[model samples]
Target: MSDIEVIVGRIGRAHGIRGEVFVDVRTDEPGRRFAPGGTLRMGDKRRPATLASVRWNRGKLIVSFAEAPDRTAVEQLTGELLYDHVPEAELPSEKDEYFDRHLVGLVVRDHTGAERGTVSEVLHLPAQDVLQLDVDGEERLVPFVSALVPTVDVAGGFLQLADVDGLLEDVE
Candidate 1:
């Protein structure tokens, strides 16, 4: 298997006595990533497991793995990160869309072509996606919107952000 792994979800807590666990999905396509019969890796070690079942409960996802047969078994998996080795070629081809893996580590620059920082992470919120940047040892959360982030030149290894006053201000 490839060394590259894309984190898709984080196991929350054991939901029921039958080993079902709630998952905080991190991928845009939860249905595909958390689908039954899909295989997912756990943690940095990449422990392999196959999804025995997947279902929705109270607007959240509940998943069961073949390795986890009871609440006691799944409880041990709580807080574990789930990952899939999705190749770059399999990423979405829609214009102006990018995978989180592609965005991370890209240089961030202002409209005037001044270097600001590097993308450290991508936060997927319910309202919108945000880019987490590491600037001068400080973290900045920039909204990933067209108005604010005008260009994403992945090939060029950089992205341009519109200068928004107070947007990059340090937050306490």
Candidate 2:
């Protein structure tokens, strides 16, 4: 919704009769979704649906939109999203490291610095997050760990990784 300040989490399913939902967070940090008393916008760029209640469920966080006070209200948002506009001053980036958002649109290159493809999306797996890329008419899944992605220039919006050793062997 709106600009989606930031996706705090998502509504998984209806909880109990009172009102409850679940969130499968996609952030690099596991606990980023359950930041208590946060707000989420549904759609558009104006007033987002504020969150009234939030909790964790089976490692996933459950959030109740501030605007919804009943089970029916929560059910209506089962498939929608939650967002927050985190200020720049609040970013927790570290040296030689950048958030996954910065790598959304960048060219992936080989060790020789050859164009392999363009990154399309970033996936967060329980083990590790991977980059989904489209290269030379083929899709490539590159691991997003430090060993693979050794360098990330956030301002430049590009990523450089070590030679993917047999990384594509299984993909073949």
Instruction: Name the top TM-score candidate.
Output: 1
**lDDT score for candidate 1 against the true structure:** 0.87
TM-score of each candidate? 0.84, 0.76
Question: lDDT tens string, model 2, 1-172?
Answer: 2332556555678878777777667555535545557555664443467667766657667666667777898887776765666564354545555555667888777677776677888887778778988777677788888888887766665677687675433434
Off by over 4 Å in 2: 1-4, 29-34, 43-47, 87-90, 93-97, 165-172
Best by lDDT: 1
Q: For candidate 1, what is the TM-score?
A: 0.84
32 Cα displacement, candidate 2 (Å)? 5.8
Clashes of 2: 10
Window of ten residues with lowest summed lDDT in model 1 = 163-172
Q: What C-alpha lDDT values do all the predictions have?
A: 0.87, 0.67
